[model samples]
Target: MIISAIALSLLLFAAGAPAECLGEWSPHVVWHVAKIGKLTSELQLGPNGLLYALCGNKLIAVDENGNKLWESDLPDGSKSGCPVFDARGSIFIPGNALIQEVKLNGSKGWSFKVYQGSSKAAALLTTGPGNLLYMQLPTGLYAVDTAGHYKWMITQWDQVYNASTQLETDWEILASVGNDQAVFVIIGKKKEGYTLMAFGEGGKIRWRYSLGEIKQANLVVGGNGRVYATVNPKRTDDYYKGTVYAFESDGDGSPLWSYAMGCVDLTAPTPSEDGLLYFCADEKLYALNQDDGTEAWYEPLPKAISRPSVDENNMRYYLGTEDKRLLALNTEGRLDWNLTLDGKVSMRPMVGPDGYLYVVTEAGSIYKIKDEAPESDGG
Candidate 1:
């Protein structure tokens, strides 16, 4: 795709956006890292900037040039959630029957079953506040220390703390940043009720808000001192309804604001750097005002969004789709540009530590991409 370079320059200056994010960022592959030729959709860029993936029970780390760093053998059924990194730079995997760890150098670290006498693998694992690992199992979310020891269980959220209040596996966890860094979670049971909880200091509950009965919910820590929560109130046959809410990351009481819409809507919610909450529902992408939950704009989507790219700048939003397309929506909520990939998007497009958009495909390809405004000079 070719565009007038002179006009592009003017657009860049008028918008006051960075060079890379000016307008119509035409995506071109900078390099190819791996081409395993098989579907390796589950890939994660580690803290050290290396791409990590699980092909079967073997965890492999690869560099930018497709060079293999190291491969470690994981226990059988070690595939589910992506690999998570701890503060000490160790990797954790949700194995079928255990919470496994891989050291920084690709060597096996600590491996232990989250729940004894059970073969059910963890549904999700994330590095939470206080340098602890939070694992979602059938019984509830369990906090595990770096040394592979079970620290605590948030099984029954109710104060009664008995068998009757058990909430099961309906919960999601995320950690906030800044001076008052903390952990937040959405936990509850079907029909009974659902609520959001914030943990601070020594894992003690700091605040809670009742959310009625929700089928699913997603929480995310935004750039500022805000926490965003989106929920699917109920699935009404062919249609679904959701409500997006925002809360002060550290303050108490009800949500700062709530907007009806955003949930199948079970995917993790995403917020842009400049304070806009992105929600994909009913085949449309809606951008909401972060402060007041007001609707800014929305664009029709070819398909439901998979994972969203929270670009460093507010100029553009990159979204992965099940339809094998990399979509770029401008601040005005228009699908101005798109790039076709070799296969369906496997992982969310992420801006690596080095500032390049890293996109992984189901065809086992890692693409390092740069977005440049279209130019008159054709490629």
Candidate 2:
């Protein structure tokens, strides 16, 4: 099932343009605290209105007021992308050897071993429809139900067409649940390039699309049913050339449009309320037409761009830089304000329910900042 209308509305609004531009903007730090261990992944807002931070081998839960709720250790090292919250309010952390479930009260629920062999690295974990949890292992993808029962497992060996060539398959980097409840994964083949595959409920392959020689891939599902992927050049010396591909959500895997970029977009494409796709790359923020893949506008940043996050009201877009700065941009692609952090920010800033932006630095510091302007006055 899709998210609730209220939640979807908020997401669309945040991704979309604001109703109007702001006159002046200022942000002030409300609170700052040091985490227990080095943050391993981005901060995820839980269903209980608490923020969960993966720090080394531990999971730390903190409130909006910067109070620590609870801290617990996972079964194994958690190098997975991020922990996801299921519909039942439980957090699932995919570790190297096992998948650990934690209840909202900071208690362990259950643990399931993903693989029996010595290698136990899980690259990605995401929630799909039917209350199912999807995981990406080195061998392939596995699906588990809410009760922690293994539904089905699909490996690269099962999907390869030619057995004699012995093509090597790379680890899955991106996985997302589409609007139709199908699971989408991007995998790399040694000589044949990259393949985007959609899997049905019973571990069946719905469709697969191939793109040649993709060095970096970032995927995002739009507010509409379109799937957007940014593929960078494979050669490290030439990172400026890239392409953005849009796929239909109906499982046919047909391309809607492909837009070539002047620079490689290392970040995922974000959809705005106005149906434009936004991404940061090479010290600039680019807005593209979602339907036709045409350039709408581009805004230059003071430093190389990092990941970006949109506010709930679609009023501002928050982004970080390699130069230790957090920036807020209005819908018109103009800079609203910016603040320098203690260290460089590699991750996107997360907007909390308490009307504050939670930013994490590379030095393991977390800061909660609030806008000095009033919300009603469009600051």
Candidate 3:
């Protein structure tokens, strides 16, 4: 597992390093403090670099430099959950069996309740031509207005799950995947199978694809307006190989293409801005044409490495390994650079708005790697 110094230099460059940070290398570079401790549940960066996190039954807000701003606990008898911020700066958090909206200034906006249980996740969607679409995962899929007024609740798709599993124990809730204009919902039991339902802004089902099995992968939509999903066959005594299905947005049960990955596909694949979809198979990163599921490029890495992270603008791919080294590659599958860390890296490297590479480790350390000093011709 020894990484050469020359290899480390190339990896750093390929990882979207600025010009000033290249050349002469420091054995180990450490940055200032960002945040300590594992995030309680989920962490999201809000508008203007506001960091919001769900810590147990409380919602904590902090500045970019790890300075505490304020923490608001859920109402009297409520428990705190993950919060999602919409495009309009409204914060959505689940409390008291309802999904409540709060402004950034700590003022109550609106609240929506459900008879089944608390909300799992929520997103504010703005459809084409300035239409507002709100989605929440609770008892079922809800379509609502900005003011917390219920426009419609989808009961056509039957969903029922155990009250103890937080919506994943069994197939009790229908999940929505995609942005404002397009959403896909999977409904039905695990053993009995399920169906993929596509919908528009107004609670209309555009199309439905019979999956015939249970799928747990997050729904990914490409720029070409197609839905990419994976299905896993756990039981049912059938030896159906795991496959990734690509379906057109406007069609009815017509699979544009299907690719057999293996026994299962575990990760959610993201389509890059350059019309290339990236997914990890057999400990290697594979880039496929977003237009059609065809291999564009791939790079082999150690089996202990984590998933790949791509910079759509810089056209670089990054992967970290358990050997305390980070690998980088260009869009054409060329090695760029590799860097050694103080310890094993767990969290994914976050590219900040200020063009700094923020890599956080499992041992509670955030390294801000910046360009050391730009070289000059003695001018």
Candidate 4:
């Protein structure tokens, strides 16, 4: 993944150019909160519209004006998962064998023990409908309600697979759908030599798909209500290869479609606007039809380190390269403009709803950059 460092440094360099101009936009820094801390996760927008930054065991909330509101300590230091909010405006954070809630005032609120005898945490926390919470540990998946009452739990995966192992598997709950049929339903995929499984309400195993032939897998839920998996096969080549697989989010059976690429894509398939899936492989950009996994097109470019982030207002794509540079690609898969940043973009440049680009660098600074282009005025 780090192989593109030198080649990417020489690629396009442009500031924030007008959305109309195909060339470049000179970068205009609106405001930046510099040297915040060792940022552990991407900046997440809180329910009250404040920006939440998770730094190890601490949580900091900052307002839109780059002013710090409050800083609080978490029960356990987390290396993954962003803070999620419930309907009543409480924050849910993950920790060792437990889930902690914090009120809007930054005071620690309630706690729920996910596992009876475990201290190891997967550190993955997600919220579903009715303020239902989902927590992932190395051992299993558990759910709790808004009042911290335990709901359902799934820990018998070895029995689900009809295979036993004393060692714990890191199971990530991918994109989920919550409705009448289930409180929070999910289709999950595990790492190297992975297994795909779908679980509905009460931790019922709806279906499972075995993909023992692959070496790695990533799952993303698309806007079209289906789960997409890009798996890499065990190979002897220099490049890591991945094929895209599509599965219905609510269905009980087989994958709808699969598309194999001739080149290599080590990242998960990025779902862009207008029903397009974008991925970079071997200095080339490829787009696929999200519904059927058909190749819409492919174009050459500098290697990409991060998946593309779609600017919904102007319909453009932004991606991070290996040499701390940001590249912009037009909707048609052509280079539009790029920008050089202070450090390897710790997180992909996110196009904010307020029409500014929010970027974080390795030095733990959140940069608010002007996004000049838009498909329509006053977005």
Best by lDDT: 2
lDDT of every predicted structure (CA atoms):
0.64, 0.72, 0.55, 0.65
Q: Could you estimate the TM-score for every candidate?
A: 0.77, 0.85, 0.71, 0.80
Order of candidate numbers by TM-score, starting with the best:
2, 4, 1, 3
Candidate 3 global CA lDDT score: 0.55
lDDT of 1: 0.64
lDDT of 1 at 136: 57
List the candidate 4 regions with Cα displacement exceeding 4 Å. 1-26, 116-121, 129-131, 160-192, 213-216, 233-240, 262-265, 281-284, 374-379
How do the residues 1-379 of candidate 4 rate in per-residue lDDT, one tens digit apiece?
0111232222222333222335644345556676667677667777787777888888877666666667787765766666778669788887777788988768888898754343454456766434578776656768798788888776645365545544345544443333333323233344444567665666676676765545546666677667777776676244434677788767874889877755444456678668888766665667888878888998776646665678876787776676666677776778766666666663557777777777766766666666545443422
Model 2 ranges off by over 4 Å: 1-23, 116-120, 161-180, 236-240, 312-314, 374-379
For residues 148-223, write the lDDT of model 3, one tens digit per residue: 7777755435333323334432343334456545667666665777778777766666778776765554456777
The sequence of per-residue lDDT tens digits that candidate 1 reaches over residues 1-379 is 1111132221111121112232555665666554543423356777787777776677777676555666677775564556777668888887664688887678787886644234343446666666777665545556788988878776654556645643444433221222245666665666566778776645667788887767777777777868887777775443345777888867884899987653446355678767677767666777887879988887787764665766665466777777777777766777766777767773568777666677777766666676655672323
Q: Which 10 consecutive positions of candidate 4 have the poorest summed lDDT?
A: 1-10
Candidate 4 lDDT score relative to the true structure: 0.65
- Decoy 1 TM-score against native: 0.77
Query: lDDT by residue for model 2 over 121-206, one digit each (tens)?
Result: 56577766566888776567778877689888765524644353442244545445444467778876556567788777776777
Clashes of 1: 1
lDDT of 4 at 170: 52
